[model samples]
Target: MDTAAADGTAAGNTTGGRPGRGRGRITSIEVLCAVLLLALLGQSWLRSTLDVPALRTGATVFVAVCVQALPFLVLGVLISGAIAAFVPARVLRKVLPRKENAAVGVAGIAGVALPGCECASVPVARRLIGQGVAPAAALTFLLAAPAVNPVVMVATAVAFPGEPGMVAARFAGSLATAMTMGWLWARWGKLDWIAERALRRLPEVEPGSRWRAFTETARADLVEAGGFLVLGALISAALGVLVPAEVFGVLGEQIVLGVLVMAVLAVVLALCSEADAFVAASLTAVPLLPKLVFLVVGPAVDVKLFALQAGTFGRSFALRFAPVTFAVAVVCAVLAGLVFLGGAR
Candidate 1:
């Protein structure tokens, strides 16, 4: 009611009448994290103490996933910083579409230029869309940036060992999924709701001052993008520990199961597109088609990716859009699998 009370309310102090809702909001987040951690610990202890092999198996899966991808998380952030600093936003925007379909194609091409994990792509894509990029193009970049980068290609090659075809499948599969998802979203989804889709002109700094701009942009981007990348890795790790691997094996053999595996990996790995190929290749236990699905889906969707979409667009957009993308991506992966990777080698 009063000025002091209003300030208190904003500060999240409930005791003071009219406490700040904003301040309370931050505190609530911390409290939620603490509660989750405690629950995880309790479940972990109970599962271990009970000597249940299945329970321990879930925890192992969660931890393995998180730890396996932590390095890539850091790498993605560092690379993102460089893009923010040295690369002009306008340069990226210029490459995107004046039309919807072109926008998606441009976004996919743009993905090769900026190498980062799924989480890192969120901010970069947001900046492009916020600046003047079309929704179709931004979505394309959002799906492709993680999957099509050079770093990821090398990783795929290495992970597949003797199989060059594996690398090819990953690249082609990812490309197909990115392009298809973009066109689909533009055609059927609620394009009107995407806040970042309509980017305007990016602010221009003088050419002479480019070095200074690079340094400043890189610093801020590393902090923002890198932080989220770590958060994503942690979520993936938790999922890995909680789910059993063998369960994913049988399903991976079937066309439907392969899609489902990809969908789940999209949620579990939370990896950058550039790095996910290697991870997918290493999964020799799963069918080739399923691994391809994993590669395609990870870049398009993940828990952290959803969190970012919610923040940038709105909860409603993320809630509906992620599932839609998941379904579409699975279907695309299935089609790709059938065409190329359907039969076992």
Candidate 2:
């Protein structure tokens, strides 16, 4: 074909061809418009159908959870950003003990300073290992950073309201779980289990740009964590209404069964550590001890944390660590709950 004719044909195709592909690439605004249109069309039907007491209660609970938790989530992500972008890794190196066992204890306690979620901790832990910190120490920080942080503690307190013991139990259980795992790793963990990639050092962000880095980091984390928190609220609300009340009463009596069930639920939910408190609090069916287990275990060894650990530390590390962590967290949580919350009632 002549150059002019070919150019004309290309222009036409660019303007009008591949209609199906264009339609398939739907934008968020387009989806919103479609949803609005459907809502308008089904307005009468929805009004009649959704007027049931159950649906109203569920919706109210869902909204309440999201509203109550979102501000805390924002606060957590902001603190996480400050830790990631403002704090220098050199500060950790100087602060941690030279002796491996002592370092593990220090690292576990240092978790109080970093308010990031489990997902944020994985990369930081891997970087710590790469930067010549002991693997056990880094792992301790990894486990502790999410569960024992101030933002998460605040959220737990808010979620449980007057139940000050729940806050204490969760804090003690999660810290104990992290420290125990660290000690176990120091004694028996093999270096070969870690992937080499996890040992490579990451580039440090420039100190001067920390403010910009902080805001950007906070915004990104908030967007990702917020979506998961909203989803968790929806699921908790739905389960609140759908699950039979008798089920809770029966489970409440079976302490062991309730503990195991909540642990399993923690793994399945894979909730953000900052928001899991509200979800756990919403489950009034189980005893306080089980709910305590759920809060403690969810942040330490959920499916999300397992996957992140596998990707960063290697499959071998995750397989061994997750199960052990799960067992330890359950035991610690049950004991702490008994001590703080008082005898599974």
Supply the global lDDT for candidate 2: 0.89
Task: Tally clashes: model 2.
Answer: 0
Poorest stretch of ten by lDDT in candidate 1: 195-204
Error of 1 at 223 (Å): 8.8
The residue-level lDDT of candidate 2 at 185 comes to 97
Ten contiguous residues with the weakest lDDT in model 2:
15-24
Off by over 4 Å in 1: 1-75, 189-191, 195-249, 252-255, 278-282, 342-345
* Clash tally, candidates in order: 24, 0
Model 2: per-residue Cα lDDT over 168-228, one tens digit each? 9999999999999999999999989998888888778887888998898888888878888
Give TM-scores for every candidate, taking all chains together and pairing residue i with residue i: 0.66, 0.91
The RMSD of every model to the true structure, in order and in angstroms, is 7.4, 2.8
> Global lDDT of each model?
0.66, 0.89
lDDT of 1 by residue, 242-285 (tens): 54577656665565766675669667656656446545544545
